[model samples]
Target: MATERMAFDDLPPAVLAGVESHAGEIVKAEMVSQGFNSEIAARVFTANGAFFVKGLRADHKRVWTQRREAEVNPFLRGIAPALRWQTEDAGWVLLGFEALNGHHADYSPGSPDLPKVADVLSRLGEVGCPDIELRHMEQRLERYAAKPSDLAHFAGNSLVHTDLNNENVMVDGPAYLVDWAWASRGAAWLDAAYWVVWLMAAGGHDPQSAERWAGRIPAWQTAAPEAVTAFALATVNVWEEIAGEDPDPWTAGIRDASRRWAEHRKAA
Candidate 1:
């Protein structure tokens, strides 16, 4: 479902006051349309400079995602937009970030951004998951896995940004990952597997070509074929659960893509 958005002027006086206190007087505020998770996403111009801001009401069910984003920001550093400030005031929670003059990454076939995206993933694969409370990959996918023991293949110390869709990435001097709400701690190759589903969704790649792209990362290349297959099947099951309820076109498409990849793995 599309998230409802709020314009800067629609912000409560207390919310605006709190932001300006840290960001300086806002001269301009341009709404950003890339992410659906936040109620407010914008580029605000302050005397200090341009910064990106995203927020949600404190009582919203997804309010915990805002805190997760904030908690993971410092660890992301060059991998994500830098966190500038955060606030909890006037019944809202907001996070501010460095506004990059960048666009959402292009995942379509032949786009040069693919290599850049690969590079970003390679770097992230090197960072061991930090010691903090985070959902483990097994825990997050427990409900979707075909068998509980299949979940064992997913355990590891690597930090992963499970939502690797292009919209959560910015193609800048270097690709920066955004939207840490779904970050997971798991096997390093897990992220590469997730990206395969998204790459196929963007078109032009069958399951085979998509795996080749994922293979560019060392972690993925070294991942056990059976473990990767288990992950692919789990993805299919997840989309199945989602589509069974709402069945949006996009969800159906991703479900098909994950199924194809899982089938190919079984055949191999």
Candidate 2:
């Protein structure tokens, strides 16, 4: 699902003008090569200040995600970099963010960044789900669940950032979660479960150690054993489909880690 990247200067003249209308004249722009969602991702220095900008063509299939991120930004003030401005013009829709100063969180075993990530997830669980348009977790996983009834385990009104890839979290003085496009309403405990999978794949933590780290999150204590087991299995099905479609190293890694976690859950 990665979009083809575009350089800042390659944008249409009108699109560049629109960006400057909100951010003042662009002095310098550096392409950010990490994330996969945005077609155009960069850090721009304007007379006003520095800001992170990401956008996609209006006709792109995944363009809806651009609007989703903007809608969800108001609720993520402390947990994410603030949205400073957004402009849609000349066939492109762009958003400018506050340009957080930090590096992606390190999920490797025994790293100090782990505790900072825990704090961010704990705070995210407390945010009330807004009345805006958002998908529910059960609906998202229904096609992959073991049975229709088992989907209830994922239903809730709490806000959930369903994607917990290490790159989605930034760490410095205070950790921040980025990429709100996949945010959904779901059970509070599900985010902790998502983190467990990433911990194994990105941190080399075994299932037991991953769950131990998940225990640091307050919501994880509320998760029932059967619910977690069901989630582990559903995660395998979800990633299997994703890896099958994409056939990439990253997707394969997640699919393999998900299967290992499911195997451990079944044995327990």
Per-candidate TM-scores read 0.96, 0.97
lDDT of 1 by residue, 72-189 (tens): 8888878999999999999999999999898888988899889888888988998888887889999988988878899999988999999988899899888989889888899999
Residue pairs that clash (backbone atoms under 3 angstroms), model 1: none
Off by over 4 Å in 1: none
Looking at candidate 2, the ten consecutive residues that score lowest on lDDT are 242-251
lDDT of 2 by residue, 41-118 (tens): 999999999999999999988899999999999999789899999999999999999998889999989989999999
The top-ranked prediction according to TM-score is: 2
Note the Cα lDDT for every prediction shown.
0.89, 0.92
